[model samples]
Target: MTMLEERPLDEPFAADPATARRQAATSPETADRPRSISSRTFDDRMSLGGSAVASLCLVWLLYTVVLPMSGKLGFVLLWFVAFVLLYAGVTAVSQPGPVVRDRIASAVIQGGAAVVLLVLVFTVAYTFVRGFPAYRHLNFFTQDMSSAGPSDPLTQGGIKHAVVGSLIELGIAVLIALPLGLTTAVFMTEIGGRFGRIVRTIVESMTALPDLVAGLFIYAFLLIALGQERNGFAAAVALSITMLPIIARSADVVLRIVPGGLREASLALGASHWRTVWSVVLPTARPGLATALILGMARGIGETAPVLIVSQPSAYFESNPFHNPMNSLPLFAYTGIRAPDTNSHTRGFGAACVLLATVIVLFVVIRILARQRRARDARPRPWTRLARRASS
Candidate 1:
């Protein structure tokens, strides 16, 4: 009370005039300073706009100014290089070094993907355009080359025999390769041991073996050694050989990636190893296995040398795989294109288009099957439903 009476009560709380002025001057400077890097925000729209504008300008400049001087052959390369550099530089102006680097990398990857998609679209469009003349004729799909001469119009000839042969041979090849490949994959991934390693090594080695070599092997074994005639069966054998390694290796990799905990859980629940693999592992990896099969089919279906070497290309329909020569889409296209006639050339293109369509159809079917499997897996099983009902 004595001390408070000695000095005014407000004196202790009041700021000195000089210190208050210094604080007032420093506050604005502190507030105006730039934020830390962690607090900074990037304008993605601005970056994207700048990148697009720079890419367009660079492409135009090259097309108009640089092409005359440098030639048009390297336009794509130049454009790619210019766009990447310009985009990176533009981003760097507003972003940190790491962010700029990431942006550049993403741009390059996206550009490459776009280029690939464009190339695929262009190829399909060009093939369809060139083949439309023959494809438009209904007979081109209903008749055989045997009934039509080289001088005949597109309406007179078709790929019926080749289509039949191709289907029969590919069917045989898949029937033989699928089970063997799946078993080998299971052995490699689930039953890994010394034998599995040896099998894996052999599969890896076989993957690099030439298609022609496989054809020659089958040709020698079946036609030369066994004194058998050229037939669709022999062609199917060669195709199976070519397809086996592809399916086995791809499936092995797919199966290996299936969660080990699932297998352990199954085993702990008193299931046998084989049962666990069949019920749990295979079901989990079925979609991936289907993809592997598709790859195998794609590799085998387009092979001309194997079918050409092992089976004589037939012009007439021959459904028997074991006795007589057989025709296929690849052989049909090859033989047709060799004929010195415009109609024949058109037929060849038409056959190629048909083959392409067949592949597309197969891919769509496989995708649908995969989607159905995924949907089925997402639904509760009957046992699971029963268990839930019992619990309730």
Candidate 2:
């Protein structure tokens, strides 16, 4: 019988990086070009266009002459239904049963996605437009609302307090939740037992827990039972409760995607489970972990009820989360928008814009870091370079 070759300890996760790099000069992401390879035929295009036009005509006729429906939303709904039926009918005449079904499905999917995208774009655009005046003032980023009244100009008061409070609260929440969630994820993924399964079941259950209930839980436990003051710390704790399950669930999924081969290799090399996870699994799943962090942060950062319930709103800035009252963007926006004044409305819109921008920026920054990590992994290691030079 032929002898079997064993993998070296140093190269457990993958084969020699030097060999792979030398075999291919460019990374897959760098080498590949994106080009659509859709297989739509002329008849397919004709059927789609004809159906859309016919649907619009039919819907318009129904609204104007047949139906009593006067709402734009109802018209759109009817139009979509008409289009699906028309498209399927038209395709069924010339194409196979499968093709007709596929065409109809594609139209519905595209239509649904278009509606969502349109709604998203409109919302962002509307908020920006409404908040343009407030965003234009230099004081909007520098000043707080301590001295400004409701009738004050956009230039007089700003969301500075809300911004600072949100940062402090979210920062605290991240610190508390990240490690706990990471540990929980590791327990569920690497050291899975009956306890781990129970933890997973609880996490999955909490994943759908509503924002209001999270606030109420914290409110009842900390503010009422423990007699804790309404402050940024309480808000942060509430936010952590909201964030914990999200982070744990997301990290669990991410860690689970780490290859079984890598885990087995690590074990075979005499590494303990903890060491294997720390050195191999965690590092390998870094990007996904970053995504989990983002998801957690995104969920908590914009929470309104938690902040509303457990924290006292303040117009002036508060630096300490453990100290007196604080305000966040969502809370600030909600209060401002509900007030009966144009200035408050402008401030509310501006806060909304800022909140949106914050989330987008955070997402972009983390995604960039994730991309950098992937790119670094794709690059040949230092020892790989040394080995290549010696081999050459």
In order of appearance, the predictions have TM-scores of 0.82, 0.86
Q: Which stretches of candidate 1 lie over 4 Å from their true place?
A: 1-71, 382-392
What does candidate 1's lDDT look like per residue over 15-112, in tens digits?
55544534543466566765343332356556666667777777878678766656554667776787788778776665556767777888789888
lDDT of 2: 0.87
lDDT of 1: 0.86
lDDT of 2 at 34: 44
- lDDT (Cα atoms) of all candidates against the true structure: 0.86, 0.87
Off by over 4 Å in 2: 1-37, 382-392
Candidate topping TM-score: 2
Clashes of 1: 0
Cα displacement (Å) at residue 154, model 2? 1.4
Q: In every candidate, how many clashes are there?
A: 0, 0
